[model samples]
Target: MRRDNVSADTELEYNLRFFTQFIINPARTGAILPSSDKLCEFMTDLAGLGDVSTVIELGSGTGVITEKIMRKKAGSTTFFALEINPAFVDATKRKCPDAVVYQSSAENVMKHLEMHGESGCDRVISSLPWSTFNGETQQLILDSIYDVLKPGGVFLTYAYVLGVVAPASWRFKKKLYAKFDKVETSKIVWSNIPPAFIYICEKASR
Candidate 1:
């Protein structure tokens, strides 16, 4: 079935089920997979990606976001998609043959970049469900992203609204306030069943 034909909720459920079964134990890992098209368009629009020359996506499931990034095609910008699940990684590679697909976790993204002699990325977009992650794991991934992002780079992510959706989490809010100079959020995409919010964070100027 074509993506456009599927309802958003159905698509979300299918992708979530795929992640839960093959990628991470939904109960243990706390990874909630968003549909590829929704996440890709959301990240691209949030990042104002027209000027960005390179992007690194964390938890690129089934290469949905990768394909979206490819659609933007700003100059010769390169997209690096990281997926911990082997099956998802292979799927992403097949979908976006131009992308540099890495079968690794977000925590190791910087290491992979270093190995490739890449100093930093222009933007980092993620779909990892932070609410499901333990505090340490969450901090580790965030720190790694900060380490690899270029000065003035942006980090974009999505989260489901639970108790409080505006700020997302106290910890994430604190980190963004302390580390980034600017952090903005967009209105919830009601089109997405259950809805989701997008956070756009920009690194502080040196």
Candidate 2:
């Protein structure tokens, strides 16, 4: 079918673009391939996108997850994505023509929220490479996430199965437990390359 062909083409293009970005800056781009469909579906489901009002996605890569979020989010939901890589940003925009994909760092989410006349968002779904960031960089973005989310909001992100034993991943896990009122992990998505699991963190209600 035409749609299937388009999807296949998009996947190929994204894989090429993603790999290029990862080679250019491994620390920032992280993965050599964009997330798989199963991974994207699992993340959006965990976010409870149907109920959220304002949603923000960090590190949208080639918009694989961004496309999923767009499909799952409520009709009235205010959604936008932040991606620091210009090539990734462009790819995301091209893949998701109507999405508000901003070429900015994850730490700058607040400015975009302010632009929307919102003090906070109901959900923050991130695809950021936590293991690649230094302690300071991790804390800076985590702090920004905590500050920008409404009380009782959900923050969802994923960690690669292979990276679980890494020290930086452990540090990021501890930080999540310390920052959020509750932290939970999803079952591993074995179909994905290298496999991955989601982290669902909730802020305490006021």
Candidate 3:
């Protein structure tokens, strides 16, 4: 079940995990397949990884983004990947051994970070589906993210091109606007399946 090395990703299993998981829980998994290389590139490029001492990744499904982050900025910072799915945590850990993969919810990020003796991170890169959660759950996730982030920290997440039109997606956008000082939306990443856009959010700089 484990790969020989962290870099080795079996093409078949990688595709199945995302597809099957999305079918079972479209809201949580979000994507029909793993995020595309181009999308990952755009997100990480704006992450400001060089300045942060600590960064955590949320909802790391099959470690596509996680792997890309590790590959690009592994030596610059410490990454702790928090995923709710045990299977995903396993795959992410295998793919990104340098990262600390925790099977935990984003709502409990503070507790998990403390349990691991980690500090509030400077950036949070999430792949969680905000449009699926009810208002309360959405607020809870945002609250948790805001609390765990350093005052001037940044938080980033992506949404499908189609989801932007949904009421839930707009509501989520409003939540982001309300909670953060600055929220920057990226141009569409056409290479991704279903196409998508990245939202680069940041708290006010201290």
Which 10-residue window in model 3 sums to the lowest lDDT?
1-10
What TM-score quantifies how close candidate 1 is to the native fold? 0.81
Query: Which scores greater on lDDT, model 1 or model 2?
Result: 2
Give lDDT tens digits, candidate 3, residues 88-166.
7887776677778889888988887787677688889998988888889999999999988888889999999888899
Better of 2 and 3 by lDDT: 2
lDDT of 1 by residue, 86-109 (tens): 867876776677788888888998
Model 3 earns a TM-score of 0.90
lDDT by residue (tens digit), candidate 2, 1-206: 12232477767777898998888999888898888888998899888889889999999998888888888898899999999989989998988898998999999999999998889999999989999999999999999999999999999999999998999999999999998999999999999987999999999999
What are the models' TM-scores?
0.81, 0.96, 0.90
Leading candidate by lDDT = 2
Off by over 4 Å in 2: 1-5
C-alpha-based local distance difference test score of model 3:
0.82
Please identify model 3 stretches exceeding 4 Å from their true place.
Answer: 1-9, 74-76
Clashing pairs in 1: none
Q: Candidate 1: deviation at residue 64, Å? A: 1.6
